[model samples]
Target: MEYDFTLKYQLAADDCDLDQIVERLAEAGCDDATIGVGQPGRVALVFAREGATALQALLSALEDVKQAVPSARLVEAAPDFVGLTDVADVAGVSRQNMRKLMLSHAAEFPIPVHEGNPSVWHLSDVLTWLNTRGGYDIKPDVLEIARSAKQVNLAKEARELEPRINQQLEYLLA
Candidate 1:
């Protein structure tokens, strides 16, 4: 299977030389990715990799990036975090239509990850909801890749949490 996904990173101050980073990435098994270094301290790699599963492909890319840029911090793994507009684009529907669906099915709609000005959600959650309703033409691989990206982002964030706080939150949230 070929999984399509993106991995974005925040480069360490010492690791911000774009040319060196690009050369290193190419040598580190990331020749399959389209590298983006527009931002001064950031890099985004859009990859189409082959593996048995979405997770395997994504994880391998993650590992390759880490090896190539040891000082860089993983900022996000995407197609995971998005707004209604993003979802609408992916679903081939107008933004207004997608908003209407969310409003009409507010109770059943998947919860947003952040609820403010422009709210955001996990793409897989919205896709799963649409899939259940039987009208969207979502690709299975897209859903799998989105899910895998979400997992990767969560795991990276999890590593930053204090174990004690995690335990307390786990118990309280549960």
Candidate 2:
């Protein structure tokens, strides 16, 4: 079976250039790896395998890279999924608060579904909602109000600002 593996490494402050790391990995026989810049100073490498031996080779290459860059961290490697959930895990808020947020902010929250009801949200949908909603800071009402106000103000400001902005641009160009 084919499998995808993701390896993450955090670079030190001085080691910001990733070309060297990529070169090292390539030299170590990891030619088919895709490298990307992640949040802040982290780098991510994605590798694919066709069998257990290929996976082992990838792991060994990763280990070699890790030894060369001791600051790099091996975060995780798993199958990709659309969503995930842990019902009892509520670290960002108290259990009661989480329940309150769920109850009061139904519009902002992803709709939960009953097993028998197809109209209900899919597990993936609920998980997507939870992940997004969990990180959201504004209240539902506040968000609505802010959004409406922003629309109104933007329309008004655009009408007023466009002429002046255009004049400035014309002046700069001239």
Candidate 3:
């Protein structure tokens, strides 16, 4: 018997800030994962499998991603198996980097769906690995610069509206 499964996800604000979702999927026993942008704040994942126990593996994978990235909204779909290269694209990392990370710590990487052939990394595994490593912090000056920029933009917007407000007042008087 063959078991095929798919899972999609919509990420929340906090979830967007990290790659934990991908890492978690890998831990759950899924193989061949792909992620894509849905709406502005949504992320979709498609996982595939082929085995008698594929369905059970898929469910385990989904639970893992959900637990790790609580803000993620999941949507299951029909499996459309993708390659490791595809998973790399979704993780925003190069294939080389993915391999390097996995090779560095084999225990941390996801299990391959097939015994032999083009090896594929599960989406959940990638997310779980990412969750283990937190994001980089911004420099203090960079944050200050961002704050200044925001203030400038707000001031410019207010200035632009002032003329319109005056014009409306004049029209009302007339």
Name the best candidate (by TM-score): 1
Candidate 1, residue 18: how far the Cα is off, in Å = 1.1
All models: lDDT? 0.94, 0.51, 0.52
> Which candidate order results from sorting by TM-score in descending order?
1, 2, 3
TM-score of each: 0.97, 0.40, 0.34
* Model 3 segments more than 4 A misplaced: 18-20, 23-31, 79-174
What ranges in model 2 sit over 4 Å off? 50-58, 80-174
Better of 1 and 3 by TM-score: 1
Worst 10 residues of 1 by lDDT: 8-17
> Could you give candidate 3's per-residue lDDT for residues 1-174 as a string of tens digits?
233344556677766643555566555543356655556666665544443344444555556666666667653333223356755665577879767876787886767644356774434444545556645232333223223323333344456577879689669879
Best by lDDT: 1
Q: What is the full ranking by lDDT, best candidate first?
A: 1, 3, 2
